[model samples]
Target: MKAKGRVLIIDDDAGIRDAAFQVLSREGYEVEMAGTAEEARRLVEEYEFDVILLDLKLPGVEGLELLQEIREEDPQAQVVVITAYGTVQVAVSAMKLGAADFLQKPFNPQELRLAVSRALEKKRLTLENIYLKRALAEKEGQVEFIGQSPAIRRVLEQAEMAAQTDSTVLLTGESGTGKGLLARLIHRMSPRAEGPFVAVDCGTLVPTLFESELFGHVRGAFTGATQHKIGKFELANGGTIFFDEIGNISLDIQAKLLKAVEEKEISPVGSHRLVRVDVRIIAATNKDLREEVRAGRFREDLYFRLHVISIQLPPLRERREDIPLLAEHFLKRYARKHCKPVEALSPEVLEAFLRYPWPGNVRELENTIERLVVFARKPVIGPEDLYFAGFEDQAPDLTLEEDLPLEEVEKRHVLRVLRACGGNKTLAAQKLGIDRKTLREKLKRWGVTP
Candidate 1:
């Protein structure tokens, strides 16, 4: 889809405003014009523009002062400063005030187009990065992991301990068990919390482009290497780099990564000079890295480096007592997001959640609750909304052994309930309308516990 963007032009001279309007409008932007800094400030108060062409010399108010006002109002607005031949120093000062680019008058149409395009592209990328970071933050905070269960308490203590160290950490967990969330928590609690926290999913990167993206490349490094670029290591210098699914990288890339980690420096492709960086590494994987090392799929030396502080996140099924707390958390979040008034879950729904064995772990439960909140016709979520699919074939031993057909249904339900509770068996049993002892017997018989 083509992105819709608005452009604001501010110039005292009528001729300059008209020329800018014509050029920007022709480039598919919705254009707005202002003759003075006062008019521009009024327009800015009423609306937001993707890019603003600001004249350095205004009639009364200076351009640099207006630039400061615009920045205070909307920091994300991209401003391009216009300057005359003798006023280059003013344009340089404007750049310090957050001007995205500068155009010297009288400028050609092609130069104007190029500067506008570059500024808008930069603004778009910045907005996208902000959106992704906000989404990741929401996901990380949704599951609080509160529990008194021995297994869960131990995991929390280990997490706290890991947060204090600068050594590389390796988090192993089943899919949806919140490995990414834990990585973020560790970074937030560390000494480098004020620095950047960059997370990358190694599985999503193509092998051909992986090297340039991770360590960067100099100009002319490859066919499309039009300019020198700073890679993730440079961007995340003096901070932490969370490598999600690190096992997905190829052996060639792994060796390069090991050298960078060990030497604390990176040499961009096509450049002999090395750039020194101080970055803490946190690696996570769902697969068994030791097996990969033994099979020669992963390097033994790299495996040892990443496993300095090892942590294994327990799956939802293993810590069934925490479900109700998690479910309530999800319910409140989804309600706020969807503008819903749903206040609680029905008894039957809570029972089903506690009985279900959540093969997909915490993420699946969060998704299920969000779905329930969005589609629920009533104020409370009930058992009818619970549907567990795709697990029928794999766990026949567990499902078929139960006399009740709803046993599989109940298993799905109970697991969801426990996850909602953050795996607290007493609270889960209470939510399930059963006593703690009865719940314990059922868990023992069903081979599920917290």
Candidate 2:
């Protein structure tokens, strides 16, 4: 196989520099040469190198001093010291000064190749470590906890316990319940936090691409699959892979997923070789898997495999006490984000927020707060400033006449929300605090085409 890195050769001897350049170049390295320390320093300023070969003896500035300069310039740069056969002790000192390895004078081609290869590999790993650390720092900030409700505290406690192990976790909740954020929290608290955390949405992935996406595929697996693709599982090896909307995956996909989860190996679509992956699976679904399995749409074995640790997130309506805290937290966050002067929510707006059922949960609450912050004419947000999706003016009144029959009130409220959403049934159902199927049944009974 061809070498896959750049190498810089800094040596005073014409023959040594020429020989090193030729060997490394023929091995597919992009090689360059500098005859003196000054020339090497100039080259270093111009381009990055994976490996540097430095001869200890130079014309003016000695190789050891030049090595110190390189280290001070870029501590992560890989360097291999070159010493004369009589200067074994100097090689040791150079190694102490951060040389990846040492090469003695008059070394054979194999020694040169091996030393360069080792140094290049070391540099690659160092870069990967730096990247992973930066990613962890950045991704850690993506999920933030704002509410102090007991429900959320319980979920976080369970997450802390789950993070201590490598077992699979299943998060069940309504849409916009922040399942994705909780998945991220579990990953950040886990021992494998140093590795990548990949989230895949099963609902968005079509059936034809589901297997290839999760298990990967070799080049030419099918039409348009021109190159080998690394699957989410392989990318998340030694870390975690969160599958969202897990209930939407087909039975065939579930079977393959079960095998990979149970056996810890997945065969690429066209390749016979099964790649081993040590990934922790954290799946989330809004639907109950037990019902899915009973209905024969989901695999029973897979359900058992994933139900090891289940966390059910309570809806925003159930956790009504947290609405004010979450509302203020969102208000402040969105105010700063949008550069708005709004400092607080009006008592009227807060009352409206508390009284209204947040069918869309935290995500919707956040969106509404952002909108209110952007459009606020005063320093405080009020009911008049409050905005709900599909509601052009203010949100609908949170109360209904209690004297009406229950059925009559339910029909009128559902119809009112439906009209507010401009006849969009899904949004209407969410506003009515019911599932789409139940909404459809109500609509059918009312003799509506929708």
In TM-score terms, which candidate is top? Answer: 2
In terms of lDDT, the poorest run of 10 residues in model 1 is 388-397
TM-score of 1: 0.59
**Over 4 Å off in model 2, which ranges?**
1-141, 387-397, 400-418, 424-449
Question: Residue by residue across 250-269, what tens digits does model 1's lDDT show?
Answer: 99999999999898877777
In terms of lDDT, which candidate is strongest? 2
lDDT of 1: 0.77
**RMSD values, in order shown:** 16.4, 12.6
- Per-candidate TM-scores read 0.59, 0.65
Write candidate 2's Cα lDDT for 1-450 as tens digits.
534776889999999999998888889998889998888887775555678898888877767789987765445558998868547678777888899998888899999999998998796576456446645654635577666789988988999999999999999998778898999989989999987788887866779999998877766789998766667786676689999889988888888899989998787787665455778999998887898899998999998999999999998877888889888888888788888888998888777778665656787677677777878888976666655333333344467565755556556656777877889998776555455655775789788774
Model 2, poorest ten-residue lDDT window? Answer: 388-397
- Global Cα lDDT for candidate 2: 0.79
Error of 1 at 449 (Å): 33
lDDT of every model, 2 decimals: 0.77, 0.79
